[model samples]
Target: MKNTTISDLKIIQIDKIKEERGTLSVIEKDVVPFQLKRVYYLYDVPSDAYRGGHAHKELYQFLIPVSGSFDVILNDGYNTKTITLNKPDKGLLIVPGIWRELENFSSGSVCLVLASEVYDEDDYIRDFELFKTLKTT
Candidate 1:
């Protein structure tokens, strides 16, 4: 985790196929760096609400805005970055050991999360202070 920085965060462009009917986007195993183990989404969130105020120990997540848009605030315990997800054909790849906060959600926005691991409470570092302390050591 010492070498992991904000630069490790990547904006992955999903493959989009356009035809006469409509556009289709595909996300297969080759597109993502890790093998997907779980999938979920967030919807009907209030505009002022915030989510994901924690950092994962081993889980890697790929976040996609399936509908509408939202902002993802990422902190690597040293630097911070705020990225907006507005397109369905692009996704943000969040590596492990990075604190993430989801906010500024537009109306009717849907945030799709693809996880590399299953739900594990022990893998989460929920306190910012603790995360910072751990990153320094």
Candidate 2:
């Protein structure tokens, strides 16, 4: 596997059009680095709770806080970094093999996720220790 670090994480700025009544955000397939094949989101999370404590072996994801804010903790099997997502126009790109955890969610925070592949249980690495070993292999 190529070296993937927190620095490799991309913050994508999707185009947003604001009008008098409401706002619209656009995500074009070609504009992003990957060809999106799936989409999901998380909302109504308790303020004190955390989410995403795993890594993927072959999937890529882009996350955005559509409503409030939350912190994304990224670990590349060695180093770790935390990034806060608050803007609807900004999306965080999570590459494969990086352990990720979402924490410090504000009340009513909505995390919208766009994925590069469909849901596959075999693609997920839910254990951090196992993920660390996979990175070195």
Clash counts for all predictions: 0, 0
What is the Cα-based TM-score of model 2?
Answer: 0.93
Q: Please provide TM-scores, in order, for all candidate models, with all chains considered together.
A: 0.97, 0.93
Steric clash pairs (candidate 1): none
Index of the highest-TM-score prediction: 1
lDDT scores for all predictions? 0.95, 0.88
Q: Give residue 51's error in model 1 in angstroms.
A: 0.7
* Model 2: lDDT of residue 25: 94
Query: Which has the greatest lDDT?
Result: 1
Candidate 1 lDDT tens digits, 30-129: 7889999999999999999999999998999999999999999999988999999999999999999999999999999999999999999999999999
Q: Cα lDDT of model 2 overall?
A: 0.88
